[model samples]
Target: MTTNESIGDKFISHRMLSSFDINDELLQKLNTKGFTLKSEIQAVSDDTLRLMCNLSDEQLNTINELIRKSHKTIINHLTVSHIRKLSGNRIHTSLPSLDIALGGGLEVSKVTQICGEGGVGKTQICMQLCITVQIPEQFGGLSSHALYIDTENNLRPERLQSMAAFCLESYPELKQRYCAESMVSNVHLFSCNTNSRDLFELIMSRIEHFLDHHQEVRLVIIDSIANLFRYDYKGNEFQREYEISQMGHKIKSIAHRKRVAFLISNQVTYIPVEGKDTPALGKLWQTYCSTSFLIKRYGEYRKTYTLKSVNIETDRHFFFQITKNGIKEVLPDEVVDAIINNNKL
Candidate 1:
């Protein structure tokens, strides 16, 4: 049997399967079943494989061993420092205090969740990041494109245009390399009007192709991932959670493999036990995020607290307001004064 010597750490293709002594008929069957990539095959369960492809026990064992070997070859053993050095770069938020609190800015190759109630500026922050990611590297930016997956029909082009204009105006020198029009254009927006199933399919099937063609896209923003799941899966909690886990796994895989950042916005649900609102989708979904921020509206200013994070201290909070330009950080004194004024009124 020929070995898959040339398939070192890359996606398992039909040609590579030939090296495993998989016959042409079996290869065609796998293709028809959509088990094209190693990740796709690995994601499938043994039961599903048996039902879908009619693979016997021995054949299943062989395929599983082949995948394990391929995965082993893909794993890199490195020191802690080496791994940190290899991590993706950050994308600044354009706010000094917020960036400092984030230990730099939004990190690539990780999922960051922004959770908040309606009109708490979750989309505003996402829109700001879309523009900020386009800023030149000299200005502490990723200098790349951003993919905005709008599921709630909340993305406003006028808002993006205004934010981009202000971002450019803040740094006149950036005009040499960037303009408001170009920055706005770099943000690729997709409206997923269908149900949660459609969203899942979009992420699993279309996203990889989109990213392939737009290699410059370093950030992928799914504004309000909770929206898709809100109306769908009304009572089937188990199925809803299962689909969420699968979608999140695919998202994390793409983020790490492509070296891109993923920012997913989540809705807040009133937790009866806590007697307050919490990020929706339950704990299962929360485990997938590397960092999470909970935003609350207080008078004219909005407060964002670090609900959970791997790199930053929890309970750390900051205040910001939404202006025509975009999200601007509000100082502590300003927050206090605003509260006092609102009390007087």
Candidate 2:
């Protein structure tokens, strides 16, 4: 039996790929078709792959399993002490009640998925995080840069400008230290279009450049990870799920291992019944995420509900409203009641 080491998450060495069930003709087809890495084979669509490689159903299933094993089994163990060490570099969302609801803040090396309907302030929270992640550690930040991947073309510069101004005004001592002047520069904002393929290729291909050069970045925010799939991929559930789930897995592998935090916003699909709707990408992604939250709009108030969390209550809810400054705290119902009672008095 031949053995090969995992090279930067590779399934097997390119030369040893033929040691398996792949015939010479099939291997030639794969090489000519430019399928090198196991991840590439996994990421490609089955229909397109069929056209390219003319693979039978059995062969395709085998290849799929190989790819899955490559990524999943390659990293099958993590010690508790290792996880504890990684969890130390937590980044606060800076919304006090929301922070309390989150049991502290977003942990380093974890995925926090925020799901909500359109206009539910998911992007607003992302924008706020891009700023908050840079706050000095004394004030509950990682004191590092942020990487913003705007998949739906929603990285609002005007909003960042206004928010940065507010941040400077709010944290005058930090402003005196000149943190605000270069805040946006530390936060790399990228706007990706509707095509998921473009987004995927961009991340996988260009990751080394940014990830290596920007170790200072502690948070990566994908403003609505489900946006590209929602508009496209109608009637193509398998391909959509495969691509999205694989992308999710890849992002998790990179983010956690690099000790960087990920905040991904997922859109919601309405159910028109009880519970109203659920996260758009379904249960695969719901569980793929370390913690899942949902945002709902009511009149002028928006409530963020935790749908899934390992260490926090799923039933817990936090009230917040987006203001010009950024995602700001809003009075809870009890606080509102107390205010009304005081006014009556």
Candidate 3:
């Protein structure tokens, strides 16, 4: 009689029209089974069909209100397949050269978690990406704007200027767009203490402000997620875990909602194990990241990092390194590939 009354697997069918064929037989079955339609079906505008199908009225109304209030949060992400399609799209960054290492570019609508020990160029890679995405496509970078939320004091105007100048050496016409001060200006930077509730508030405020003005925001980078948990969380163990898990889901939602590439840098610490080396954040953190990259010191100076897991292969681990300028491709050589492919490493 009511929405919740038909609450078994039959009720689930009302949510998605795509789940049912439009045949007379299926329609007759649906009618006979009392699996008719959700109340919201009548109000389902073309744009909101996916939203309606994927969420209950409660979830849809809550997220719909969020979109109405904020521009970046307004986009919809109902299905895992839809989310993956969004993440697979192109991303323009300030670092054109570095795009080569990212298999085209950093994921546009996915959360890319870059984890590394201290002094391993994680910040630098992020900065380079900021620079690379803003350069024109001709130079191997997508010319687009970026947002950098700095929980750490890693952002420097002078450094961004140098990278922009390097980008201009080849693309002289890019001077107007990549002007050191101007380009840096395009990069919206927000500094907030790690543990403060105001940090999350500040982030939300920026998104709301941008949405208010319908600002075009395509890329978002959070310098370090660990710092946020370390400082802001009261660490009640259970509560902290729940909060972190919720935050991870929210971050992923924002990336999809905004249709913007989200890259978050993470700090790594030694995980004690009796035998082999262990990852810092381990399995829990890995679950939140659509793409997880690990940066390790390979040669004396040739620090290599690799895509440990991506959507394609959640467990595929590859390796590469950093150079004086940016990320370098060090594909597994013949001998090394043989050893690895042969299950040696």
Question: What ranges in model 2 sit over 4 Å off?
Answer: 1-86, 272-275, 334-345
Q: Count the clashes in each prediction.
A: 0, 0, 18
Report the lDDT tens digits of candidate 1 across residue range 129-172: 99988887777778899999999898998889999889888899
Candidate closest to the true structure, highest lDDT: 1
Preferred candidate (lDDT higher): 2 or 3:
2
In the range 1-345, model 2's lDDT, one tens digit per residue, is 121222223212211244455557766766565453343455558987878778888877777666556545534543333333434467778577667655578877667888888888888888888887888888788778888888877887778777877987888888765455478777797778758887877666665468888888889888878778776788888888777766765676566458788899988888777657788877666644667888888656677788876445576877777787887777686446545655421
By lDDT, the better pick of 1 and 3 is: 1
lDDT of 2: 0.70
The superposed Cα distance between candidate 3 and the true structure at residue 194, in angstroms, equals: 4.7
Go through the candidates in order and give each one's C-alpha lDDT: 0.77, 0.70, 0.56
Best by TM-score: 1
- TM-score, candidate 3, is 0.63
lDDT of 3 by residue, 160-222 (tens): 777766767757888765577777777888776545465556554555466335345577788
TM-score preference between candidates 1 and 3, better one:
1
| Better candidate number, 1 or 2, judged by lDDT | 1
Which of the two, 1 or 2, has more TM-score?
A: 1
